[model samples]
Each structure stands twice: as C-alpha cells, then as structure tokens.
Target: MKTRVRSADFLGVVVKYMVLFIAVFVVLFPLYISAINSLKSNSAINNLSPLQAPSHLDWHNYVTAWVGGDLGSAFFNTFFIIILAVLGNVILGTMVAFALTRFDFALKKYIMGAYLLVIFIPTMTVQVAIFGVIKDLGLFDTRFAMILLYLGTNVVQIYIYMQFIRRIPMSLDESAMLDGASYFRIYRSIIFPLLAPATATVAILQTIAIYNDLYSPYLYMPSSNLGVASTALLRFQGPYSDQWNLIMAASLIIAIPVVVIYLILQRYIFAGIVAGSVRE
Candidate 1:
C-alpha cells in the first residue's frame, strides 16, 4: 500500500513537470522562430526552414525597418501615450475603488452593478458613437484621442483595487479621522500608499493593453506622424508585404520594451494577483 502511494506521488510530479514544459514551449516557440527569421534575408527565409538560424547575420533588416516604418516616432508616441493612460487609470481606478469600498453612499449597489454591466458590453457595438463623439470634440486624428479613450476606469482595475483595499483595516481610517484628518487626506495619505501592490498590478496590465492596441490608433490617428508601435507595421501592408525579414525585425523591436517590463515586474504581477485572489 505504501509503495503504491509513493508511485502515485511520483506520477503526479512527472505529470506536473510535463505540463510546465509544454506550456513554456508553447509560449516561447514563436518568439524563437521570429528571432531567428528576423536575422535572415527574405530569400533565405523562403529557402531555409523556419526553425533554422541564419548562417550570416544581416543587421541591415533592423535598420531598414526602423527607418522605413518610422518606428522611432511610433515608439515615442506609444511610450508617451502609455505613461499618461496608465497614470490616469491607476489614479482614477484606485480612487473609485476606495470610494466604493470605504464609504457608504446611496445607489452604491447600482453603481457597482453598472460597472459590472460595462464589462459585458461589446466595444464594437458602440464604436460608431465613440467615433462621432471624438470628431465632435475635435480630437480625431490626434494622440490625445487615444489617451482620452484609454483614461476611463475599467471594471478590472476597480475589482483588483477593491480586493486589495478590502483587506486593509478600517481602523487606519478611524485613526486618521480621530486626528482631525479629512476623508480626502486619509485617502491620500493612508489608503493610497497602502495600495502599492494593487497599483503595480493595474499599471502593468493597462500598459500592455495600451501598447498592444492597434485598432484605436489606426482608426483615430490616421496621420503618419501619430502612428504607434502596433500601427507602425501597417506601413508594409501593400507593396512591402513580401519583406518578411524586415517585418520580423520590426516586430522584434516593438516586442522588446514590454518583454523587459514584464520580466522586471513579473514577481509583482504574480504576487499581486495571488494577494487579490485569496483572503489573507
């Protein structure tokens, strides 16, 4: 009976390892292929196996793609927009979540329900209305249009913040109030500082979202100068479609920033998520 139990435990370990390896491969295989293909010439990519590395590295592909795609400007635009959007999202999201959780107000249930309802609404259904509003506000064909659209607090941010904030003891607020601190002062000094974990999680998520969003930039900001990292690839759509090496090089360049960011903050992400999930 003991031998059988040990065998079962060993089998479970082996199965877990196998699943982990498969998941890693599934995530990394495309990145590996892209890195290799980006170094090869267009003709070489056609002749060589997709898995094969380049015999002679050609650095020119990156240069051409960078300059031709106007990726420098695109990256700058993307970075600027992400900074503003994420900052706005974190501030507004935290404040709303704090208000909803810490204070008792009328229609609170209905407000929370409305936020839940927003998560179910398909973005495509109301895009025409959004477009009209953008044009009427004279924000069309501008980077600010993207920023304005992205600045709104979403339910995910609110939920994450609420989960983290709920765990914070109300005694802190009472203590501050007893010291003659105002509600806003307690929120600013006490609540906001303690929400660092949730804030980090929300910032990372919002940053990736705004970075990868091709549709908003493409639709609202049509001007070449205002192009973002995702839309930078669209320049190769018509005539340069056959240039896979340059395309891959461009893709690799665009992918670097977010990858580095995730690597640095990945610990925070996992911790924040776990912290939010289970009651501690």
Candidate 2:
C-alpha cells in the first residue's frame, strides 16, 4: 500500500511537469527559433542545418536591422509613447480607483454599474466614436492621441486597482484621519506605499499592453516612418517577402523589454495576482 501511494505521487509530479514542459516549449520554441535564426548568416538562413546552430554567428544583422530599418528612431518614439501612456494609466488609474473604492458619492452605485457594464463591451466597438473625437480634437497622428487612447482604454485596469484597494482595511484610513493626516497626505505617505505590490502589477501589465500594441499606432499614426516596434517589424517583409533573419532580429529586440520587465516584477506580479484572486 505504501509503495503504491508513493508511486502514485511520483507519477502525478512527473505528469504535472511534463504538461508544463510541453506548454513552455509550445510558447518559447518560436522565440528560440527566431533568436537562433537572427544570428545566422544569409547562406545559413537557407540551410536546414542552421536550425541546429549557425556555422558562424553574424552579429551585424542586429546593426543592419537597427540602422537600415530606422529602428533607432522608432525605438525612441515608441519609448516616449509608452512612458507617457504608463504614467497616465498609473496616476489617473490609481486616482480613479481610489475614488471609486473609497469615497462615498451620490450616484456611486449607478456609475459603478455603468462602468462594469462598459467593461464587458469591447473598445473596438467604440473605435468609430473615439476616432471622431480624436480627429475633432486635432490629435490624430500625434503621440498625444495615442496616449489619450491608452488612458481611455484603461478603465478595466483602474477597476482592478479599485477592487484590490477595496480589500485593504478602511480602518487604516480612519486611523490616519484620527492622527490628523489629510486624505491626500495619507494617500501619499501611507496608502500609496502599502499598495506598492498592486501598483507594480498594474504598471507591469500596462507596460506590456502599451509596448506590444500595434493596431492603435497603425490606425492613428499613418506615417510609416513614425512606427512602433510592431509596425516596424512589417518592414522586414517586402514585395519579395523572405528576409526571415532580419524579421527575427527585429522581433527579438521588441521582445526584450517585456521579458526584462517580467523578470524584474515576477514576484510582485505573482503576489498581487494571488492576493487579488483569493481575496474578497
């Protein structure tokens, strides 16, 4: 009986990890293939053996991709848009979340209900409405337009922050008030620090969203030269359409920021997700 129990446990563990390994391979194999191809010479790209290893690693593909593709300028422009969008989402999202969760205001229930309803509706459904507004505001084709669109689309994220904030004890607020701290002061000095884990989660999520987003840039910013990494990757394919090396190189570069961010915030992100998931 004891031997059978131990065997069952060992088999379960093996099965679990086998499934995990397969899932990881499914997700990462493409990226691994791209990275390997990016380092291969033109002739190696044509050879099936390049899948094993490049005969000689060619680093110049990275430089050529950056310069010839105008990726450097695209990187800077993308950086500016992402920075602005993340800042706006964090600051405004936090404030909105705080108000919705903590403050008691008239029509609060109605507003919250409306927000919840809107969350179910896809933003694409409102693209016509939003595009008109952007055009009327004369922000079409500007970085500000992209930033504003990101802000408007962040309602669900703000609601996530609000849900997490609500789980925090209201007594903390009462105690701060009793100690003579103004609401703003308490938020700045106390509440904000306590919410670091949640903020980190929100920031990481929005960073990935803004960084990886291509459709918004394509729709609003018509200038091919002013493209983000996603749009810029299109340059790798042309009428001929077979420079897999350069395409892979651009993709690897674009993926770097997301991977680095996940590495840095892995713990906080996990903590936030677990806490938020199991909590009321």
Candidate 3:
C-alpha cells in the first residue's frame, strides 16, 4: 500500500515537470528562432539552420528595419493609443460596476443581461457595421477612430471591477452617507482608492491589448503618418518583402514593449485574479 502511494506521487511529479518543460519550449522556441534569424543576413538565413546562431553579429538588420519602418513614430502612436484606451476602459468600467453592484435599479438585470449577451457575439461579425459608423462619424483614418472603438468598456473589465467592489464592506459606504456624503463622494474617496490591485491588473491588460492590436490600427488608420508598429511592418512587405531578416527584426522590436510590461506587472495580475476569484 505504501509503495503504491509512493509510485503515484512519483508519477505525478514526473508528469508535471514534463508538461512544464513542453510549455516553456512552445513559447521560447519561436522567440529563439526569431532572434537568430534577425541577426543574420538574408543569404546567411537562407543557407543556415534557424536553430544555429549567426557566425558574426550583424547589427545592420536592426538599423535598416528601424529606419525603413519608421518604428519610432509607430511606437509613439501605439503608446499614446494604449494609454487612452486603458484610462477610458478603467474609469468607465469602474463607474458602471459600482452602479450595478451597489445600487438597486429598475433596469439593472436587463443591463447585466445585455453585457453578457454582447460578450458571446464575435467582434468580427460587426466590423462591417462598425466601419460604416466610423465613416459616418468622420473618424476614419485617424487615431481617434481606434481610440473610440477601444474606449468602450468590455465585459471582462466590468466583471473584474464588480468582483473587487463586492468584497468592499458596505459599512464604510453607510458611515460616509451619515455624514451627508454623496454616492459619488463615497465612491471616489473610499471605493476607488481601495481598488488599487484590480485597477493595476485592468490597466496592464488593456494596455497590452491596445499595444499589440494590429487590426484596428491597420484598418482604421491607413495613413503613413498614423502607422503603428504592427502596420509599419507592412512597409517591409511591398518592396522589401524578400528581406526576411528585416522583417524578423522588426517583428521582435515591436513585441518588446508588451513583454517588458507583462514581466513587470505580472505579479499584480496573479494577485488580482486570485483575490477576485473568492467572495465573502
């Protein structure tokens, strides 16, 4: 009986490590190939195995990609858009969440039902209509168009805020009301400040999503001056399509921001998720 238990534990340990190793390889392998290919010339890449490192460091590919793609402006554009999207989503989501969870209203259940309904519908199906609306609004080919699209609060943010707000005690709200504090005052002064963890998690997530979004930036903002990092990569495609080294370097360059962001704030993400999962 003891031997059986020991064997089962050993097997579980082995399986867990195996799965972990495979997951690590799945993520790191492509990044490794991209890094190696980005360092070599087109000729060197064609001749050598992707797993092998370049014989000599070639910094020229990065320089070419940066100049040809106008990555500085693209990065700036992406950064600006992400900041606006994160702020808009967080503020609006927080307010709506506070209203739904705290106050009793006539249309409350219907409003919640609507949010649930929209999440199941895919965004791609509505793009044709969305595009027409943007044109009608005169927001086409501008950063504001992308900002407006992303600015809307989504189901995920609403749920996260609700979860955090639920955990906050109602006693604090009642005490503040006794002092003639308005609902807005109680929310702004007490509730919002206490939601720092949830706010951090939401901001990081929304920032990363907006930063990495290629579709909105590509479709809505077509002007060269408005090109984001993902769209700017298109410049390498028309004439420099054969320049795989430049393409690889450009791809890796654009991915750097989100990677750094995830690494830095990843702790908050886990904390928020775990904390939000439990309710009193």
Candidate 4:
C-alpha cells in the first residue's frame, strides 16, 4: 500500500512537470521563432520555415530596419513621452492617494466615489468627447497632450497607492506632526520613502502602458516627425510588408527597454501587489 501511494505521488509530480513544460513551450515558441527569423534575410525567410534556425546570421536586417524605419527618432520620441507621462502619473497619483487616505476634507467621500465611478466607465465610451476637448484646446498634435491624458487617467495607480498608504500606520504621521513637521515634510521624509514599492509598481505599469500605446499617439500626434515606436513600426508595413525579417528585428529592438525595466523591478512588483491586496 505504501509502495502504491509513493508511485501515485511520483506520477502526480511527473504530470505537473509535464504540464509546466508544455505551458512554457506554448508561451516561448513564438518568441523563439521571431528571434531566429529576425536574423535571416527576406529570401531566407521566404524559403525556410520560421521554426527552423537561420542558415547564417544576417545582422543587416537590424541595420535596414533601423535606417529605413527611422527608429532613432521613433525611439527618442517614445522615450520622451514615456518619461514625462510616467513622472506625471507617479507624482499626481501619489499626491491624490495621500490626500484621500490621510486627510479629511469636504466632499471626500464623494470625491472617492467619483474616482471609483470613473474606473467602471470604459475610456472608449468617452474617447470622442476627450478628442473634442483636446482639439478645442489646440493640443491635438503635441507631446504635452499625451502627458496630460496619462496624468488624468491614472485612477488605478492612485488606488494602488492609496491601498498601500492605508497599510502604513497613521501613528507615524502623528509622531511627525508632534515633531512640528509640515504635511509636505512628512510626505517627503516618511510617506514617500515607505511607498517606494508601490511607486516602482506604478512606474513599471505606466511605462509599459505608455510605451505600447499605439492608438493614442497615432491619433493625437499623426505627424511623421512626431511618430513613436509603435506608429513607426507601421512604416515597415505597406510596400515593404514582405520584409518580415526587418519587422521582427525592429520589434525586438523596441522590446528591449521594456524587458530590461521589468527584469530590474520585477521583485518589487509582486511585493507591492501582495502588500496592497492583503491590506484594507
């Protein structure tokens, strides 16, 4: 009976590993194909199956994609937009969250309710109205418009920060107050430092969202000179759609920064999420 039980447990472990192996393959197979094909020439890609490795490494695909796609300007524009938008979201979200969680004011409940309501309402439902407002304000083709939009649309970040802030003991704030520290001083010295994990989580999320956002930048900043990586990738299509190798290479280039960032801050992301969720 003990032998049979041990056999059953061993079978379960084997089955679990098999399932994980299959899942990993399913997720990674496409990326492997892309990476391999990105090093091949157009002719090689046409003749060979993507599942097969390239005959020889052709580094020219990256060069052609970079030069033809004008990726330098695209990357610059995208990075500029991402930095501004993330900064705005982090700062504004932290302030609003701090105010909501730590202070008492008139209509505070109503204000929190409004933010909750905004989250439920899909942004697509009000996109046309937002577009009209941007047009009227003459911000339709500017980077500032994107920054402002990101700042105002950070409800999730604010909510995350507020949850994390609530988990912090209010006694710290009381002690700081007793020491004659101003509100800003307490925030700068105590609250902000403690909220580092949450801030890292917010920055990672906002960075990915803003970086991958194709529609907003395409719609608002349609000028070729102001094109972002997503929109510039479109240039690799149309007329050159057959250049799959170049397209794949460009995609890999664009993805590098996001991958690096996630690797750096991934530890904080899980901790921040768990802390925020387990608290009030």
Candidate 5:
C-alpha cells in the first residue's frame, strides 16, 4: 500500500510539472517569436516560418524604428506624463481612500457607492462627454489633459488603498488624536507611512496602464509632435504596413521600459497585493 501511495504521489508531481511547462510555453512562445522576428529583415520574416531562427541578425530595424517613429520624443513625453499622473493618482487616491475608510461624513456611503458604480461603467460610454469637457477647458492636445484624465479614472487605486487602510488598526489614529494631532497630521505621520506597500502597488499598476494606453493618447493628444510611445508606433504602420519586422522591433523597444519597471518593482507589487488582501 505504501508503494502504491508513493507511486501515486510521484505521478501527481509529474503531472503538475507538465502542466506548468505547457503553461509557460504557451505564454512565452509569442514573445519568443516576436523577439526573433524583430531581429530579422522584412524579406526574411515573410519567407521564413515565425518559429524559425534568423539566419543573421539585422539591427537596422531598430534604427529605422527609433528614427522614423520619433521614439526619443515619444519616450520623453510618455515619461513626463507617467510621472505626473502616477504622483497625482497616488496622492489624491490615498487621501480619498483615507477619508472614506476612516471618517464618518454625511453621504459617505453614497459616495462610496458612486465610485463603485463608476468602476463598472465603461469609459467609452462617457468618452464624448469627457472630450467635450477637455475641449471646453482648453486642454485638448496636451499632456496635462491626459494627467487629469488619469487622476479622475483612478477609482480602482482608491479602492485598493482603502482595502489596505481598513486592515490598519484605528487605534493608531486615536492615539495620535489624543496627542492633539490633527487628522492631516495623523495621516501624514502614521497612516501614510503604513501605506507604502499599497502605494508602490498603485504606482506600478498605473505606470503600466498609462504606458500601454493607446486610444486615450491617440484621441486626446493627436498632434504628431505630442505623441506618446504607443501612438508614435503608428508611424510605422501606414505606408510601410508590410514592414512587420520594423513594427515588431518598434513594439519591443516600446515595451522595454515597462518590462524593466515591472521587473524592478515586482517584489513590492506582490508584497503590496498580499498585504492588502490578507487581514490579521
């Protein structure tokens, strides 16, 4: 019986590993194809199977992508927008979450419910209204407009912060209050520091969101000079639509920053997610 049980356990382990191997291959296969094809010429990519290795590396694709796509300007614009938007979202979202989670104000429940409703409502439904407001405010074709939109759309960030904040004991706030500390002081000194993990989580998530966002930038900031990385990639598409290799190279270049940022902060992201989810 012990022998049979041992064999069964070994079979289960083998099956688990096989499943994981298949899953990893499924996820990584497309990335592998893209990387290899990006290093090939357009002719080579068209003639060869996507799974085939390149005969010789062609670095010109990246050069053309960088110059023709105006990636330097795109990166600068995207970085500026991301930094400001993330900062604004983190600050405003944290403060609002603190209020909703800690304070007892009239209409608090309704306000929370409204936020929940907003999360469910698709942004496309309100795009026309938002575009009209931006035009009226003279923010069309500007980075500041994108920043404002990012901040306003951060309902999920606020909710995440609130979840983590709820896990923190209210005794800290009470003790700080007893020492004559004001609400702002308590938040600044005690609560905000405790929210570091959640803050990192929000920053990383928002960075990826803003970086990969194509439609928003395309719609609001359509000026050729003001294009973000995603929109700038469109430059490779039109006349040279057949240049799949160049397109792939440009996409890889655009993705590098996001990949690096995620790798650097993945630990913090996982920690924050776990910390927010599990209650003591």
Candidate 6:
C-alpha cells in the first residue's frame, strides 16, 4: 500500500511539472521564435521556418534598429525618466507612508479614504483634462511633463509604502525621538534603511512601468525626439507595412532591461510586496 501511494504521488508530481513546462513554453514560444528570426538575414527569414536555426546570423538588424529607431537619445531619456520617477516614488512614498503610519492627525482617515477612492479611478478617463493642464503649464513637449505626470500617478505606491510602514515598530521612532532626533531624522536615519527591501521592490516595479510606457510619451511629447524604447518600435512599422525582423529586434532590445531587472530582483519582489501588504 505504501509503495503504491508513493508511486501515485511521484506520478502526480511529474504530471504537475509537465503541465507547468508546457504552459511556460506556450507563452515563450513566440518570443523565442521572434528572437531566432531576428538573427536571420531577411532572405533567410523569408525562406526558413521561424522555428529553425538561422542559416546565417545577421547582426546588422540590431544596428539598423538602433540607428533607425534613434535609440540612443531615447535610451538616455528613458534612463532619466525611470531614475527620476523611481526616486520620486521612493522619497515621497516613504514620507507619505511614515506620516500615515507613525503620526496621528485629525484628517488622516479622510485622506486615506480619499486615496483609496482615487486608486480605483482610471486615469485614461481624464486624458483630455490632463493634456489641457500639460499644455497650460508649458510642459506639453518636455520630458519634465512626463516626470510630473509619473509623480502624480504613483500615489498607489505611496499607499503600499504606508501599509508596510504600519508594520514597523513604533518603539523605533520613540527611541529616535528620545535621543533628540527630529521626525525627518528618524525617518532618514532609522526607518528608511529598514524599508530598503520594500523600496527596491517599488523601484523595480516602477522602472518597468515607466520604461515600457508609450502612450504618455506619444500623447504628451509627440513633437519631442525623446521617445522611449517602447514608442520607438513604431518606426519599424511603416505606413505601407511592417518589417517583422526589425520590429522583433527592436522589441527584444526594449524588453532586455525589464527582463534583466526582473531576473535580478525577482528573488526579493514577492517577499517585499507581501511584507508591505500585510504590515501591522
């Protein structure tokens, strides 16, 4: 009976792993095909099946995509936007979270309630209004506008931080206060260090979000040459048609940063989110 049960359990494990492998392959198969095809010469790609290995590697597509996409300037713009946006979220988010969690204020509940309400409201519904404000502020075609827009739209991150902060011990703040530290000092010196894990998670998530963002750049900064990698993919698709290999190459480049980030930080991401979400 024991041998029979063990056999059944082992079979179930094998079945589960097989199903998971199939699911992953199903999702990644197209991306793999694209990557393989991107390395083939145009003629080779036309002749060979996408699943087949490239007969001759054509690295020129990467060069062409980079030059045609004007990816250098776009990459610089994206780097700054992503960095600034992450910085804004971490700093302001920490502060907001600290206040809501550590300090007691009369309007705190009202403010928290407002944030909760606003969280569910879709920003797309206010596109026209947002554009008008952007124009009025004379930031219609500037990277600064995108930065500001990112800042405003990231309140959810602050709320996440706030939830996490509530889990931290109040005694730490009390000890800091007893030692003649100000609120800002306590935050900077004590709390911020401990929140590194959460901040890292937020940075990784926000970086991906801001980097891949295309619509805001398109709508707000259409005349600006500071397009992000995501928007630059459009150049591969002409009015007449699209170049599949070039598009794939450009897309693969655009995807590299996000993939690298996830691979590097994924070890901590879920733990941080869970810890932040359930903080006492």
| Ten-residue region with minimum lDDT total, candidate 2 | 271-280
Clashes of 2: 0
lDDT of 1: 0.85
**C-alpha lDDT of residue 244 in model 4:** 83
Cα-based lDDT for every prediction: 0.85, 0.78, 0.83, 0.84, 0.87, 0.81
Residue 114 lDDT (model 6): 81
Q: What is the lDDT of residue 260 in candidate 5?
A: 90
Whose TM-score is higher: candidate 1's or candidate 4's?
Answer: 4
Total backbone clashes of candidate 3, pairs 3 or more residues apart or in separate chains: 0
- Candidate 6 C-alpha error for residue 222, in Å: 0.7
Give the C-alpha miss distance for residue 192 in model 2, angstroms.
Answer: 2.5
Q: Which lDDT tens digits does candidate 5 get at residues 174-247?
A: 99889999999998999889999888888888788889888888889999889898999876587558787888
The reply for model 5, stretches above 4 Å from the true place, is: 46-48, 271-280
- Candidate 4 per-residue lDDT, tens place, 1-280, comes to 9999999999999999999999999988988888999999778999998888987999998998888888899989888988988888888888898999999999999999898888878766777788988899899999887888877765688878988889899999999999999999988899999998788888877788788887778888888778788888875676468678888898888877888988888887676567544534
Model 6, residue 154: C-alpha shift (Å) = 1.0
lDDT of 2 by residue, 147-237 (tens): 8888877665666677678878999999999999998987788767777767777777777777788777877887867878777766556
Off by over 4 Å in 3: 1-12, 271-280
Q: List the residue pairs that clash in candidate 1.
A: none
What is the lDDT, from 0 to 100, of the residue 154 in candidate 6?
64
Q: Please estimate how well model 5 matches the true structure, expressed as its whole-model Cα lDDT.
A: 0.87
Candidate 3 lDDT over residue span 170-210, tens digit each? 99999999999999999899999988888998887777667
Those runs of model 2 whose alpha carbons end farther than 4 Å from true positions after fitting are 1-13, 48-50, 271-280
Global CA lDDT computed for model 2: 0.78
Residue-level lDDT for 203 in candidate 6:
85
Q: Residue 126 lDDT in model 1?
A: 70
lDDT per residue for candidate 6 within 1-280, as digits (tens), equals: 9999999999999999999999999999988988987888789878887789797789998998888888787898889888888898889889888888887899999988887766677676777789999999999889899899988876767766776677788898998889899999999998899888778788877887788787888888775386777766665466214567787888888888778888888966676667545633
